[model samples]
Target chain A: MTRIINRQPAPLGRLVLATLPFILLALVYLLASDARLAENPSDKLLPSMQSFVEAINRMAFEPSRRTGEYLLWVDTWASIKRLFTGVGISAAIALLIGVANGMIPYARAPLSPLVRALSLVPPMAILPILFIVFGLGELSKVMLIIIGITPIMIRDLQLRTDALPEEQLIKAQTLGANSWQLILRVVLPQLLPRLIEAVRLTLGSAWLFLIAAEAIASTEGLGYRIFLVRRYLSMDVILPYVLWITLLAFITDYLLQLLSKKAYPWYHAQLGEK
Target chain B: MSEIPSIQPIIEARQLWKEYGEQVVLERINLKVMPGEFVSIVGASGCGKTTFLNLLLGTQQATRGELLLDGQALDPEPSPERGIVFQKYSVFPHMTALENVMLADEFAQSALFGRVWGSARKALGKKAMAMLERVGLGHAASRYPSELSGGMQQRLAIAQALMKQPRILLLDEPFGALDPGIRKDMHGLIQQLWQEQQLTIFMITHDLQEGFKLGSRLWVFDKVRHDPQQPERFGAQVTFDLPLASEGAKQAAAEQLQQVSNPTTISKEQQHDLSNAV
Candidate 1:
């Protein structure tokens, strides 16, 4: 009998195995679209590949007569700007709060409870409250993403810091390191890579909050454009926009992983990851 | 072991007691250690061996009494006067071997940045590289701890610890995780370092033979009294302090070693008593 547990695919075979599901998915989509279009040429549920192509060209290639700008590019730029701004600020805040909560008892006593309480509250449920406080502008949209993900990132980073071996800290102290020196030298460098991992994990949620906010109140964003066409049941435009957003998220996640690999090879090495 | 009356002890513990809430870990430990002594400690698991080492390293403070160094009260915090190497995680994983060694000098010279650049960095690198070579890790200067073997990592940790030129070195089961073959090499390395640097060393070991073979003085930590109803009421203390320089103590160590090796000949209770009384 063949040993299933011990068997693993070779590199080339693994690549083929990886692509098999995606190819099957596309084929299924194509066949379903063909069947739907055969019944009714103008069906909105399953738009044909030809309609998808035409929608992409109109949104990406042609400038609108009223706005005189490519709609897809404009929306993409707005969405990306808001997403990165929110994530960047959250990362900065998480670093400070996490280090404080992990290292010092005085800071941890109060801040840990606060972060725990904040992380428990559902971020989407506070949409109206955020709009009322920050107003319906870019600030409110960015704030929504921040409010959604910052506490979680802070908790993760704090736990990572707390999990560092006690021996390392004692060794640093024995080497004549003061409090600030220990933080700058011993703790910060180890934490940078973990911060990146935290960001990578929360990027999905950040995108969710961003899209939700933009769909509620915005003039030009990927979420806004998708919601704008949904009134007429324009599946062709909506489908491509969703695919583009997925592609962007995939690229961002990929680049973050690559950056982590290049910047902190020791982390991956310790985890025994290639 | 005759001693000069004018000579001063490097470390002295007077009625030292370490308690955690209601549980007593170490109790009434009083001893004096001269400079250039290699003291090996042996005990059972959870017997407060590491706690004693931490007390020496200044990571943990005694609940009562005094721990002194150089005729002054030792600080309750870790300082450069005492350096320590643990069984694991003593060296920073984020740094290369050279960088780890250089960190001591960095922390000393640049308090704010914890870094030095330009010519200062170059000079520090040279010194760190020399220290690494002394520890037999010169060829692996740029390698991170993750890429190193267990023995090599321990050597790197030793190099990092010695960079501050601490007078007292505390090693907490540093060779316990190593293979037998690697442990012999480490023993040789440690002996040579202790002699060359004039370092007072305190090492904890579970191996009784290793404790006898390496230490100039041997200490066995065990509870002299135990209560079945309340184990936390008692704490470990130095039950045996043998100065191995004397011929009589050396002969006793050999007999104890034989008794330990041939455990089936004696009752388990006798063996426990023998270990405590060694």
Candidate 2:
């Protein structure tokens, strides 16, 4: 009998609405965990809240008896450093290659097709080859991430560079900028925000490559820790580690988004429409 | 007659024929622009005015011709000696007015990095601020181009272009998008800047009265003057070139404005002719 209104809710209402799903998910998980634990007290798949707390305390607070170092901190540090190194190298090379592809004919003629073909080759397929070439060290794991993400990032950056208004390039030339100067000055500043955005977009794939490489080999990493304990169905440690990786990814994405907003407000405004 | 060498015009074009494939854009353009001249061009859409300006800007090469700028052979390359402003898309939208103006200075001062660090940065900032002030945008230095009014953005674009103190300034319908009032203000500002800086300016506009008002000389781009049967065969050329008296142009321009405002009195034939002239 009453009329139904389909109007958008206010900010507070929207926030509550958004959080509702997460709260319901947690509630369902907790209930299932309780039911499983009541049926079988010795169950390890669905660990209790007390078990999670104990695991975190031991991993975070207590040093490893073998190496006299906190394994959790060690793993987190190792993974982060390798991730950044791989991503950094990829970003630097991609920026140059992408700019060349967009700005110069010689580079685009050869590199564009090569990058397209490389992007089609599933990076996971080359994991074994990378290990064979670089050995079972950090080099191979980092290389895997780089080879996986660089082509896509390069393609992204080149497209963005190409999409920029031709007038700016012309304007820069009239302002006394040489070809190299134009690329370094006018083109680079504009592409940076887009580069960061491209990096953010490819992070999931980057992390996947990193974890897969770690799980297959390596002695110390979040991925290595999870796989090492998997034989005994150590869901508690695995679950926390997965959540930790997700948390780290979220923070990285936020920091990058913040950097782009602060450094290139104009780019963000341009993208805000989309 | 043989005692002195021939005086070179600031810009000289000889048999400048521009084409794309079989399509002729600009045909047989032979003209000279002397130093300190305010030349305005008017034309209909697709008459190749933009293409001509591009040639002047060094962004495009003429299919056949020898172009001389400042008595030197014109190459198909852009350099800081010539500056330009388009109808729109002039300023970098991602930067503030201050950053936009300072970008060229930064690049020129430091070739690769394009950053002015420490005291040098401060000195550059002061210079950029002065340029912004020259363009009547000193107060809006921190504002983004998107935040500025249309006229303000144009002024910022002018400031950015003038940072290098270019030998020649090219404006392609620079104020075409502004309102009538803002456009009038812009006209005054450009006039003042031109006189103070002693700049050589070439502007392309669609309004005949605007061209007549602002320019010392006017170049008309029209396909009608070439061939009606082969209208598409030929693009445009400098069909009519006329110099305006400094005083009479203002008065005549005012008269033309009044005449144009009286739309009801104008016959259909007059409107048709006006449309064709555009």
**TM-scores, all models, native as reference:** 0.94, 0.87
Worst lDDT 10-window in candidate 1 chain B = B258-267
Worst 10 residues of 2 chain A by lDDT: A1-10
Candidate 2 residue A38 Cα shift, in angstroms, is 3.6
Question: Interface RMSD (Å) of model 2?
Answer: 1.8
Q: B1-278 in candidate 1: lDDT tens per residue?
A: 24434378888999999999999999999999999999999877777888988888887889998988877898889889899999999999999989999999999899889999999999999999999999999999999999999999999999999999887999998999999999999999999999899889999987766776678898878787789899999998987787875657867865654454323223466455445645
Q: Which one wins on TM-score?
A: 1
Per-residue lDDT of candidate 1, residues A1-274 (tens digit): 7799989999999999999999999999999989988999888988988889999999999998889899999999999999999999999999999999999999999999999999999999999999999999999999999999999999999999999999999999999999999999999999999999999999999999999999999999999999999998999999999999999999999999999999999989988933
Give candidate 1 regions above 4 Å deviation. Answer: B1-6, B246-249, B256-278
Off by over 4 Å in 2: A1-6, A63-69, A269-274, B1-8, B93-96, B102-125, B142-147, B225-231, B246-278
lDDT of 2 by residue, B1-278 (tens): 12323365788889888999878999888899887789988766777888898899888898998788876776678888789998877788867899899988888788767667999988988999999998899899998887788999899989899988887899988999999999999999998988899888999987766776678877767653456676567857776666664556545433443354333223344445444433
Give Cα-based local distance difference scores for all models. Answer: 0.90, 0.84
DockQ of 2: 0.57
